[model samples]
Target: MSGVSGFDIFWLIFMIMMMQPILRQKFLEAARQRMIRKLEQKRKSRVILLVHRQETMSLLGFPIMRFIDVNDSEQVIRAIHMTDPDVPIDIILHTPGGLVLASLQIAKALKRHKAKTTAFVPHYAMSGGTLIALAADEIVMDEHAVLGPVDPQVGQFPAASLVKVRQTKPLDKIDDETLILADVAEKALNQMEYNLEELLNGRFPEEKVKELAKLLSQGRWTHDYPITFDEAKALGLPVSNNMPEEIYELMSLFPQPMRQQPSVEFAPSPRRTPPRGNGKSLI
Candidate 1:
């Protein structure tokens, strides 16, 4: 009674270890279902809600809820099938970017589908997301919404990316860690070059693709520079700049799976044994 007992402490730790998965799964499943329901609810228009956030999933334990999962394409396909094929898919994108191959696959699917594909960006769509948006017939954005460079990037440290351009001394002068990272960065940069070139081949004109890739890779924050609404339209993508408040609110009011009753909340992905971390969000 005077102090905490060992048994109680062990019990508490065990409970936490066990509960974390349950809670995470529960939350993600709920979110997925809620969003799915919202997506399906608009069957009248045949819209499939696609949300990919290019930001990191989590930083310091909390998920950034920005980034697209390649795996999500499978789920999205399933959702589309469940709806009437005639219904067009409306993708609401607000992502910075993600895996190049993953983004390419999503964009390819969008392009292939007979259903009309349209992208709406309440905020920003950069990189891979930009690629996907480009595939859409129409892009809807507000004045504040931004589209970023579709450049390729590899995760080299801030230093290595510019070393060759500014190497101050001989190799031996460089720190071991920096040297190692530089080697990795060199390889990564090469891969990025290949990746950007490959992705842009058919997606954009060859001349514009190469030029944009170079500018974008070295752009703001290492991935892309900001491209405003006008630039997006100039890219030959149809654009919609304003969404009236009433229509916007109607869109927002779609049933939230998280808020639904447990009985009808929707089935969690029981097919997944371990928890899938928040199934790629576009917050």
Candidate 2:
């Protein structure tokens, strides 16, 4: 301090103070990059999560979990483009289902990718969700996990359900509106079969592929029917029952349905005498 000039010491202090925030930001950035690299190495692929559940928000003090659509084709396409084209990708899917067109867009993108793709279902993926899973080269699921029938839904109801109703009802009872719905349902089923066949072409033999498409598109099974790993394998799909251990760990991040808390009240403590004996009895 005696040897250094006053201006030199002040300048040194100023520089140190100025660098603090910059150093912190750099350190944080480096740590994030390291974590990403570690995750990629352990997972053996670039991982994406498609977790879908009813999300709610307050509207004038009323909470409602409205059905927000999941037509995220643009976002998915961007993610696909951003991912390394050479490496495999693992998509963790947990959706009940969504629009057919949206799901088809994602499926086509996955199919077009040069590298291998796998879908991991820790719980369930149904309807359109099943369609995307089918597009993957392989599917991994837990013993209890399920993939549901891929039959297209018309408006709010399953198209196959409409067709079934029309068939079972008496001719006199079936009205013009019913006839129209049945016709639309038939066309919807046909379009689904065609799309599925095109997707399954390179993966399976022509005959087997058509059979599988028929099974998926037709109303043979109910929309909510669960297709477990064994059933899926029996249907000639490339499925593996052995899900990765890390997948379970990843599932912990997803939100679960909230259970109603029990109505509990704490009892007030009873009044009690401090002691039985005293130094002197009251007169």
Candidate 3:
């Protein structure tokens, strides 16, 4: 037999390099599934995850930002349908939010589930993500995790802002296009406020429900404002800071798409205190 040539070795190396990403992806998927199964067993609930992150394309290395969309809603709803009606459901949410229609669809489906539902936030669930979390009976978050306002956005302007412009500006000064957008903005605000009230209705006093709905949907804060754990509690949400350790472990598996150099780095293990008068410690 002829000995392998340098050209053959080069091709072999190239093939292995091409296969590496595929194999890594498969391994991550399997790890995530195993973690989900373990969580389900531990909590006796159906586990679902609605995680969105920027992922890089393997060929072009261009980053694509993910969000809640119709497809995501469909898959989540299907998962809920597959689950037994009596079984509790737990959804882990980590997203920067997405389409209002998709978020509402998910929220309504979760609301209709007969069994108790929980939303877990290891980092943040913002905008539309907050909308879905509100549908859950309980929201579990890491101490620093956050939820954001659900105020609707119309084009580049906030719906509430557009409505304010209509209210504060003279009709003669407003352009035809501005008037039209303001009209749409008014409708969007009203629809979002109504939806929020509906979600909070049975869970809180009628008056409190209305209050929360208005506060969340009326653009009282910036669209990206973070409502911390304490603030959420103050706002009368069903929020807690008892996040599970396993959740953090699972999130690690879904790392941000690789960059030439990572933006953040640290020792991966917890540090232990040294004994009195001793300098040595475990990490």
Best by TM-score: 3
Collision count for each candidate, in order:
7, 0, 0
Pick the winner on TM-score between candidates 2 and 3: 3
Query: Candidate 2 vs. truth: CA RMSD?
Result: 14.3
Local accuracy of candidate 1 as per-residue lDDT tens digits, 1-28: 4899999899999888767745664666
Candidate that beats the other on lDDT, 1 or 2, i.e. the better one: 2
How do the candidates rank by TM-score, highest first? 3, 2, 1
What does candidate 3 score on TM?
0.94
Residues 9-111, candidate 2: write the lDDT tens digits. Answer: 9999988767754565466446545654555798667776676754222222222332114446667767889888888888778888877888888888888
Instruction: Give the winner by lDDT: 1 or 3.
Output: 3
Off by over 4 Å in 2: 1-38, 55-70, 165-172, 262-283
Question: RMSD of each candidate?
Answer: 13.7, 14.3, 2.2
What's the lDDT for candidate 1? 0.61
RMSD of 3: 2.2
lDDT for position 217 in model 1: 47
- Candidate 3, residues 80-122: lDDT per residue as tens digits? 9999999999999999999999999999999999999999999
